[model samples]
Target: MAYWLFKTEPDTFSIDTLRLQKVACWEGVRNYQARNMLRDEIKLGDEVLIYHSSCKKIGVAGIARVVKEAYPDHFQFDPDSPYFDIKADPSNPRWMMVDIEFVRKFERIVTLAELKAIPDLENMPLVKRGNRLSVMPVSEDEWQTILHQE
Candidate 1:
């Protein structure tokens, strides 16, 4: 039961989209570090904090649960897909994705400003400068602290 933060651009794939769809494949991760986390660390039944990034009201928007474990990201194999990788081989995948089911949408966002102001969350990667891995781990204490803001 690990905790994680998954960043998404609200316009690209918002919490609202997840809420509507119920379950969605978390794809388009290009970073090796983030890809590795999705492929190796994140697992079924894990909880996730849906963080809205690169948006006007950037913040933690909601919660989701990993309903399916990591598997090869099919988009990487499709030439028509923006995430397609020419170097990716079908026999050996270069990327992975997981299915996350919508859990809860917070009544209001827990703004980045508010998170940065929390002394206990100072160590969180999301609040740190230049630390932009889209998929990152969250400590139990940090998870509770962020949810407390909701």
Candidate 2:
């Protein structure tokens, strides 16, 4: 199964929220590249690193698994929702989402600062300058390395 990292603002949708919901539709991705990843790359049973971004201390907070494949994000059809898009239609959707099931929260947050200091992680997209994609693919080697790091 493919590995991935999905970032969410803690204030908006934290790891705690996922723990409570058990499963949730990962919606509101606006970037074309990120949307494409969800649409084409992710598959059922894929592992995902649930990351907390755009917060005081950014890090990988927990683990999740893809439970549903790509589908139109319903939030785009809701006019009252902050993620709504008038341009998207039910037939030809401009946005897509996937369902993820919470796995486990890390004992300690693997902070971005800590990740940056790892030589092997220097090439990671998360540590690169100006890199802001919320959903990104993670290499198997990189995935194993990060998970084993203290």
Candidate 3:
């Protein structure tokens, strides 16, 4: 299966929260590029690196496994929801989500600062200038290298 990196703000939904819940519906993705990756690329049984972004010590905090394939994001249909889209209809969704099961938290965070220092990750999108896709593909080698940092 393919490897992926999913970014979340630790204060909002940290790896610790995922560990407690065991599984969660990864929702609220409004960016079309990130939405496409959720709808088209991510699949059941795929491995994911839980990247903690927009918080102190931003980094890869843990691992997760996609337990369910892509499905329409219900939040898009709810008027009260922040993720709601007024133009999105029940019959034709404008967003999607996936269920990911908690796998394991790393012994220590693989900090972005450290990631940038590694030659093996030079080509990684995470280390690329201005790259901010919330969900992005990870090469097998890159996945292994990041896990190794723990």
Using lDDT as the measure, name the better of candidate 2 and candidate 3: 3
TM-score-based ranking: 1, 3, 2
For candidate 3, write residues 85-122 as lDDT tens digits.
Answer: 99898888989999999999999998999999999999
Q: What is the C-alpha RMSD of each candidate to the true structure, in Å?
A: 0.6, 0.9, 0.8
Residue 1 of candidate 1: its Cα lDDT?
99
Query: Which one is best on TM-score?
Result: 1
Candidate 2 clashing pairs, residues 3+ apart or interchain: none
Off by over 4 Å in 2: none
Each candidate's lDDT (Cα)? 0.97, 0.92, 0.94
lDDT of 1 by residue, 1-150 (tens): 999999999999999999999999999999999999999999899999999999899999999999999999999999999999999999999999999999999999999999999999999999999996899999999999999999
Per-candidate count of clashing residue pairs (backbone under 3 Å): 0, 0, 0
